[model samples]
Target: MGVDDQSTLQPMDDTAWTFLDGRIDAVLTTVRAESADRAAQGQALTALITSLG
Candidate 1:
């Protein structure tokens, strides 16, 4: 998913999309780790993970 400034710039290229995927995966992994370690926060994490989907 790419957004352009001023709603006019071109979409990101394939390499940029790959980089975005890597960053997104890193964030998801971090969230999952936190969720595993904090049962009380599972609901919030679930919401975040679901929203990502």
Candidate 2:
């Protein structure tokens, strides 16, 4: 579905919002963990390069 299709959609009820919010939270948590892991890896790589120089 596209953004235009969403315009015709009805408003969600509390139950739907609750379910969507939970899913969003789970995705956000995963993204945050992955971001942190990448940052740590970058720092380690930088340290390794510095040590070699």
Give each model a TM-score. 0.41, 0.41
TM-score of 1: 0.41
Best by lDDT: 1
Candidate 1 lDDT over 1-53, as tens digits, reads 34555233324456555555555565566666734645435555555566556
Scanning candidate 2 in windows of ten residues, the lowest lDDT window is 3-12
Residue ranges of candidate 2 with Cα displaced over 4 Å: 1-12, 34-53
Total backbone collisions, model 1: 0
lDDT of 1 at 4: 50
Q: Candidate 2's residue-wise lDDT over 1-53, tens digit each?
A: 76434333324355554555455554455556745666555555554455435
Q: Which stretches of candidate 1 lie over 4 Å from their true place?
A: 1-12, 34-53
**Cα-based lDDT at residue 47, candidate 1:** 51
Per-residue lDDT for 28 in model 2? Answer: 55
